[model samples]
Target: MARPHDAPSARELVAAVREFLERDVLGGLEGRARFHGLVAVNVLGMVERELDLGPAHERAHAERLAALGFDGDAALAAALREGRLDDRFAEVKAALEDAVRDKLAVADPSRAG
Candidate 1:
């Protein structure tokens, strides 16, 4: 009865988790309790979900590079042909994560406190 998905719907799943945590786990947030508390926990779950598959993603990247005959130590040597690894997929992904701190600060300025 469920439609197929190309990948796990992390956003929807995280949103649902947020709602669950807000309503059930913490329950009627009061006193010092805040909704933002759940954001930290839920965001970390999303981050860990991403990190847990990093090795697989790296392996796939290596495989692709190998298939393209750009591999191993030789690939490191030939890396200049593609130039700076700083902008490579892996680096871009890292930068995206780094950007999160800034974005979160923008979203919740008090988070900087």
Candidate 2:
């Protein structure tokens, strides 16, 4: 039988991850450290998915959005032209937001470095 929904529920994962990132991981670290780590992990899982999909998906989306007359080509050209980002916490987020806003996937090139 074809299953429409077989994946683990987001609610469950969110609750579990939140609890873990907050309680378990935060238990030892200081406030700022804990919060940074928490955000990092939360972001990591989400970013990992996009990274895994990578090029094939990017091309597919670029093709579709171009067909729909969106500026996907422009965005992609920008991405290709965009240089490597500096290694910083804020830079990571800035990159992600930029890619997302441009309707392109942003994969963390460096995961938990």
Candidate 3:
């Protein structure tokens, strides 16, 4: 999902670098350095997941919001604050939870489950 100038693909490039860091860079280290390397690898994994899931997540979020008759989170929040949605709080809660779960799915699928 890159433009013509993107060669090996963004996800591929990030994955390759993550692999290198996990294997080569972390292999030689210990203590805090290793911990930091692990964190870096985790960050890279998040980046790759974001690249992979961000688009679909956006689309799903927009569709969900449209179905709920809200423009976005701010509009939904305003409605909640004003008690405009009090009659349908259960439906609102389910939709909000689903939205959060979807976000968590992209940010960390394991934790999302």
Candidate 4:
């Protein structure tokens, strides 16, 4: 389906700025300035990835939570802390790992791999 916006959506705009910073601004900077520019580029890249992956991640997270018999993270955490899921430790661990993987996929794709 088409996005409910005109050309140059948020993700595209962020990517453009990131590319410009990397290609034009970073090249002319030094020391702290260059480091900050690179940081900005990395942040924008994460934003782009989040925009692309957030929906699917949300769905997967919900499914994982459901499989663990919880409705949300808060509930899951509470259950874990209360030892309610002790008997299902392996299953819970797997679900949490999948959740973390999904989060990392958007927050830091390189590390996620």
Candidate 5:
């Protein structure tokens, strides 16, 4: 038994549209239309990934910032620019790398590696 609202979650809807674009629409599109269609599909894929990964990523980012003794990105950036984190450069670098990897995971899994 499935309720109408319970079926086809937002992520599922995005996936369905992305699949349709990739499988049906892309083949029929040509020239600039095809290019735009591909772009739309890519954006939809990013949205799907964000829906799947955003919450976990948000938590991890906050944790990383806390572990680095910062409240937010602006604070962290200010500290770095002030050379306050120079002694802890390696730790900062690792945290930043992890952050970038997480972003890439949502933006483009292939590039996340």
Candidate 6:
């Protein structure tokens, strides 16, 4: 996970772009262009959060699924749909909620509450 480079890591680079878009690009636009710039900023924010948390989130998700006797998300979905997790519904629900929150944290943490 280590980058063999010097200063200005990938996260820093993304953050710089997002900041530019927010401070410069958004200020010069109007109507649709402004909307598009806002969307771009949101996308960049998601990308930044993903870069920061994706690996850890995936590890936690896999661990949670395995603890419930599933190999991965697909397997977990199958079991849920087939009622295979009926006995552990509460536990599964909690795990799923946590996973969703983790994703929302990356997609838009402000709405996570």
How far is 84's C-alpha from truth in model 4 (Å)?
0.3
Q: List the residue pairs that clash in candidate 4.
A: none
**Per-model TM against the reference:** 0.31, 0.36, 0.89, 0.94, 0.92, 0.92
Q: How much lDDT does each candidate structure score?
A: 0.55, 0.56, 0.88, 0.90, 0.95, 0.91
Could you arrange the candidates by lDDT from highest to lowest? Answer: 5, 6, 4, 3, 2, 1
Residue 9 in model 5: shift from native, Å? 1.3
Q: Write the residue-wise lDDT of candidate 2 on 1-113 in tens digits.
A: 76576665554565567667766887788788978987777676555555455566677655554543356556544544564323343644554454464343344434322
Error of 2 at 38 (Å): 0.8
In terms of lDDT, the poorest run of 10 residues in model 4 is 104-113
How far out, in Å, is residue 7 in model 5? Answer: 2.9
Per-residue CA lDDT of model 1 for 1-113, tens digit only, reads 67577545655566567667756866666545656666655675555445454466467556655544465646654664566554575754544354454444435445623
Please provide, for model 5 over 12-111, each residue's C-alpha lDDT reduced to its tens digit, 9 standing for 90 to 100: 9999999999998899989999999999999999999999999999999999999999989999999999999999989999999999999999888999
Q: After superposition, how far is residue 2 of candidate 4 from its true place, in Å?
A: 5.2
- Winner on lDDT between 1 and 3 is 3
- Choose 2 or 4, whichever is better by lDDT: 4
Per-residue accuracy of model 3 over 52-104 as CA lDDT, tens digit each: 98899889888888878998989988988999989987878888888898778
Candidate 5 versus truth, CA RMSD in Å, comes to 2.8
Top-lDDT candidate index: 5
Evaluate model 6: give its TM-score.
0.92
* TM-score head-to-head 1 vs 3, winner: 3
